[model samples]
Target chain A: MNIANKANRLTPYVFMAPAAIILAVALLYPIGYMIYASFLDWSPSQRIGEADFVGLRNYVNLMHDAAFRESFWVTVKFAAVVVTLEMFIGVGLALLLDRNIKGMSFLRTIFILPMMIAPIVVGLMWRYMYHPTVGIFNRTLKDWGFEGIPWLSDSTWAFVAVVMADVWQWTPFIFILSLAAMQSLPRSALEAAEIDGASDMQKVIHIKLPLMLPVLIVTLMLRLIDAFKVLEVIMVLTNGGPGLSTEIVAMRIFRTAQEFQELGEAAAMSNTLLMVLMALTIGMFAYNKMQEGRAAKMQAMAAKGTA
Target chain B: MPKIVLEGLVKRYGSFEVLHGIDLEMEEDEFTVFVGPSGCGKSTTLRMIAGLESVTEGEIYIDGKPVSQLEPKARDLAMVFQDYALYPHMNVAKNMSFALRLQRMPKAEIDAKISAVAETLGLTDFLHRKPGELSGGQRQRVAMGRALTRDSSTFLFDEPLSNLDAKLRGQMRAELALMSQRVKKNMIYVTHDQIEAMTLADRIVVMNGGYIQQQGSPEELFKNPANKFVAGFLGMPPMNFLDGEITEKSGEIFVQGQGFSVKLSHQKAEAARAHSGRSVTLGVRPSDLVYDPAAAEDQSLLVSIIVSEYIGAQTVLLCDCGGQKVEVELKSTIPIDRNGQLRFAINPEGVHLFDKKTEIAL
Candidate 1:
């Protein structure tokens, strides 16, 4: 090939080189360093040259650590519970507010306000609200002739409080996505359903929900991933609580490296969390690929039928 | 079978009225078609009857029962929309059986109905495929199958074939006609295509500007249109119109225009004499202009042929008659030179006269 032809082919890669280089430095380098460090018996007070190569000892030690295991279980439980609640409430609110009314834009804007605040600020705000004595919730209960309830002081109540805060901050993410999916639905299909003897509830159950499934599934996966890695809110509110009740994996990792001074163990825990998230990402992509394959098969069948 | 009636049907969007007091009566088991251009209130009238759109100031009675205030499900009617409107996520069988499932019918009966409809529409093999997986034509069939499974007393179609390609549209149009004949229901179809109206309608209602211009059998409307709009809208290639003045020469009434003058028929002469010396518009169809070399001077049009489009059996000629344009359709074998003058005899009975100012038939 001529030099001009070679240059023409290489031009696109030259234009893309800056972004590729930035990604390598900003993303891949840290992950590679973390993987290497997870195999070392290192402490924050020691230099890298003085650290010993442990070779999977930290990972082996994590399997027997009850605290780490408890934190992992707590993260799984929190993600499952909060994401389930958020999906239902968010989709329900989207359905209720999908129509046009006066000041609807303002109402939608106000609905998503919690998602816009910084996570630490949201945690602080909820912590004040869940205060055992002086919080607005306890104050309102006392005003209603009820005794002040233990909110953040009790382990069970602390879990509930943290879950509520997470739901409040993240439900809007699902709500906006669900609302967009609902609005983009084929209008004529709903009208046809109405004419086909479908009542309002039946229309929602049969037509609307089924059509919004793809968007809902993707949104649920995203929320689950976010919920697994949640830290700041629980850190500011309960600090892992009276027991390990509110100790999610992310918070446990932070406390391990800072409070326990075990950098190697923390790195090992983070690697485990990273593997779990990678599996979830792969599962999501597999599901999307399967759906695409089925669609392509149907299109082929339809084309054959026409031919 | 049910008889449908609309009394003082009015539809308004805010302050602008779209349907102005439409009153129509459809007979039992009749295939009535409402045809007009877009924004002419035909689809609005059909939608109001389907209960998709609320009637502004009207009462719709089906089988002598008022149903204007009822929900669409309360009224026993099924509608096919311009878009196919199939459930994108549901399989073809599930989409078709949704109504039966909603009614809480026996599972066996629902399955039977779905299978029968699927077989009829040739969708049996695609019963498990979602609408998004299907082609446009298959989706259209699914939409039809969904409505057919309902077995409603009335069937409403709002330009259901408008989205299909030309060939597929013709195929679907034939199938629709066959289905309508086999299942005799009170079918009301709305479309802007006049050919669909002429082929599928037991009675064609031509509307314009929110008003019913004329309603009659296809042959009746084609033979004698009530006004100029009705005359021009109901025919293929459309009717050509030329402005002329009605003049009396030697005690005979004649319609005189730029490049042609023809003696009026005896029946038309009486109508022309009453408006002599007044301006009028002459309406003629392309098929009515015959190619004749020895035609009398007073009975023919002298036209300069500009373009000839050949379509297998027939050729459509675009010709200029003085300053006015007219189309002439003839057999392709007949030789004709482009940009040359030609004479075509006018079929006397095919001529129609309308008042220039009012555009109403004289």
Candidate 2:
């Protein structure tokens, strides 16, 4: 009987062993290798064992390098601006379209089409649209008797062009999630608010937005994480040009490994980006836990009161 | 208090009409209940009056002003929904004080009103809890408290107690009666439960198939239902309906059915003489049938017992009067053997006759 009891306790771990082994081999091993490789001076021409050991030299060099600092600032700015714009536009569109008009389902399907396209495909599509004189934007400008402006040749215009493209691609994700959230809200509460003498603006400000905060917060975090790792579209557009003005950190890390041939430095840059995303994910989980804890405590007090 | 009136009110969804030209007048501080079956448009009428539904072809007047085109907030009324639509995120106090805060009332006055309403409803102890944290009964009280604190000229309840258990519903029904008496406001309630209508209504408007069948005081409606549907809808265990024919035999009026023949009283005979040899229906309440073995033949019915349901204080027996089923409410002490026939004497005053074709009282 004692042996049977021990076997019963070990059953769950025995079942979980295969998944744990696959995770170690597929995911954790590469990450561990990257962290170790960040501390060496290495190149693609030599094996990892032949590389010289360097203690924190790559990180110190990154702090003093102006180009690296500029790329890091650009990445931060790009994520902040794109996430904010996507949230506002997405939530606004959801509110505007939450009614039973004719062909509403068809309109909603078209709205989410931008999000379903492949990222590389979206980059290619926008690259054609932003072409210098042959592009639709410049052609329309010239047809209206105005001078055709450079879309990708100027540094400031390239940054603006990339931000607009990112916004166009990702805003639909927030819109769909928020529309589902709005539809699932307690409908009777909204009717009650209408009977409570609330105006149109007041109802949206007080009831609709406050109730949608949880889904909105998680959507913001997800979009921010995706924004930091953006590289495909910018790579196809200007290749980090007009002289490094739009070189986001991900593109810089790619160039460092492929073009500059500094494999160890590139690994260090990737590690830094990973840490920032980790902090954001942890903050989201902590907020969710705090909400759940408060709910559970209220339930306990209610049970005690009833008892 | 306001005198509310619905004049020729009509509601339609696209081409299909729901309420057919309803006309009603509620005096100051009257508790009127609209009772009907499902799809009977009782709730639709209440919602039209509350401005939640648009009136397609009529006018609603509050204190003698046409207000059908107005918004719900501009109607100056409070409503308690069937689902207890309390805000899930707001605490009990905030949910109750939401309307007052929107009006921009003084903070001190709002606090005082919230406390007073909460204390009356026995919700003071759970003032800080959200709707999710409270039990079902407490959430119901909070919904009531929210309506009470609004101080509107009228209060509307749309089947508020139908969601509670049987025991809790009885308790809340009594509390609603007491509250209606305490607060002298024009109250309109809607429910499918006849017992709730009979207990809480000063005037009951019985509806069926999107039309008002009858409207009167409970005692008047019970004694004299305008039609057969009203008669069957407003009583517990329902009034028994038996098909019969009116006949004149030896200068007396009689209604004869399959298994039995009953003589009418002098007053009823005189009134029923005009419709002699006409097909008719006999309506009798279960309470009017007494278990009397020595009753006269023309005044009683002989039936074979089928099932005896043993409820405390009374035993309800399901019996067959010839080919039709009939129910009788009997005292538990009545010596009734399981397999034999029994005689139930009918009260002459309790016999209700209706025209077979029209289903209207004769």
Candidate 3:
């Protein structure tokens, strides 16, 4: 009986052993190596073991470096602006297009094509569109007899251009999720709202939006985390711009290690970005767990009441 | 109170017609029940009256004003759906006060109304609980409370108690009947259950195949059904139908079938005389057949017991009359010989005859 009990206890761990080994090797090993390297004065030219030990020097330098501070601020601003715009446009479009119309499935397929494109391809496509002389916007402006605006040359315009591109590529992610959430809503409640004298706007505000909130919040968080780590699209569009205006943290880390040969500083910058994203992921998980716990508690209470 | 009149109301999906031009008029503050089997368009008719469904080619008038094109809220009605349709995110109080709040009633007034209705529904203690935390019976009560709080002139119920267990359904049915009396709003209820229609309705409209079969008071419908379907559709231990031919012998009418022949009463015989020598269906209620050993041969049936189901106060026996099966509800105290055949006297007043071809009453 004791042997049987031991075997039962070991069963789950035995099944989990392979995944645990893969996680340690593929995920933890790289993260651990990066953390260790963040404290050393390492360069790509030298072996890691031969690098001089420097505790907290890279982090201390990051604090006072004006370039690093500017990039960090820019990353935060870009994520905030892009994610907010995407959420509004995406959720609004979902609400507007939820009903049946001719060729709706084909239209939805066209709407989501941008998100399905490769990031590199998206960057190249936007690069051509944002071209000052030959781009669609400038050509349309020239035809309409308006002065062509600088899209990617000036620092401020470059930032705006990158934000627009990111929005274009990611808004469909939010749109599809919000649409699925809207479709799965209990339809009878909306009918009840109609009988309760609610107009179209009132029904949307009172019934539909509130019920779709949980899924929307989680979708928004997932997009926020993705926006923080964005790199390829901005690289092809602006490459940190004429100045350091659109230089987000990921680009800064790339340039720090590749062009400047400061692997330690790049590792430190990557760690900071990773920490911010970890907090967001953890928040999303915590929210999901809370929702599940409340649902279970409500069910348990109801079951007890009935019993 | 408003009177509702449906003049040639019809419903169609694409080109396929579901309701073929229904016409009905409900009086002020009347409790009307539309009862039928599934797909009989009873709920569809109620929904059309509530303005949840679009009228295909006719008009619905509320208090003499046309309301076919109006929105549901504009029609001044509230409906409890079959699934209750309670807002799952809202507490009982909020759900009840939703329509009131939409009208912009004062907060205090809304609260007082909600509290009063909640108290009546026995949901006062559960005002703060969301629908997810409530049991099935509690949710049903909240649904009722929501409608009561609306204070609309007309109320619609679509199988509200169909979701509850048998015991809770009985309890709620009693409550609904009592509440319908205390509150005199025009109520239209739809259900497939005949017992509910019989017990709660001032006027029961029997529907089949999207057409109104018959509509009348419970007693009128039970005693004199318009057709064979309505007779079979209503009543517990449903009315038994036996195929027979009406024959006239010396100014007397008799309906003779496979194993028994029954003499018609004077009034029914006069009605059947015109259709003499014609095939007809003989209808008798299970309660009309009483155990009587010495009844006259023409006014009684002899049957052999096949299956006896004993309830508390009655025994429902499924007996064989020749090749056809006939059920008789008997008092459990009556002694029975297990092997011998039994005879039951037929109540002449309970006799119903319908034309075989049209299935209409003779």
Instruction: Choose the strongest candidate by DockQ.
Output: 3
What local lDDT does model 1 show for residue B268? 81
Interface RMSD of the predictions, in order shown? 1.6, 1.7, 0.7
Reference-based TM-score, model 3: 0.96
Query: Residue B207's C-alpha lDDT in candidate 3?
Result: 95
Question: Model 3 segments beyond 4 Å from truth?
Answer: A1-14
Q: For all candidates in order, state the fraction of native interface contacts they contain.
A: 0.74, 0.47, 0.66
> Candidate 2: which pairs clash?
none
Cα error, candidate 1, residue B201 (Å)? 0.7
B1-362 in candidate 1: lDDT tens per residue?
A: 87999899999998999989888899999999999999999999998888889999989999999999999999999988899898877899988988888999999999999999999999998999888778889889999999999999999998999999999999999999999989989899999999999999999999989989989999999989989999999998889999999999988889899988989888889878989988999999988899997898788888987788888999898889989999989899988766678889999999999999989988
| Each candidate's DockQ | 0.63, 0.55, 0.75
Q: Which portions of model 2 show Cα errors greater than 4 Å? A: A1-22, A302-307
lDDT of 2 by residue, B262-305 (tens): 99999889889999999999999998888899999899989988
Question: What's model 2's TM-score?
Answer: 0.94
Error of 1 at A220 (Å): 0.6
Give the lowest summed-lDDT range of ten residues in model 2 chain B.
B333-342
Candidate 1 Cα deviation (angstroms), residue B360: 1.4
lDDT of 2 at B295: 94
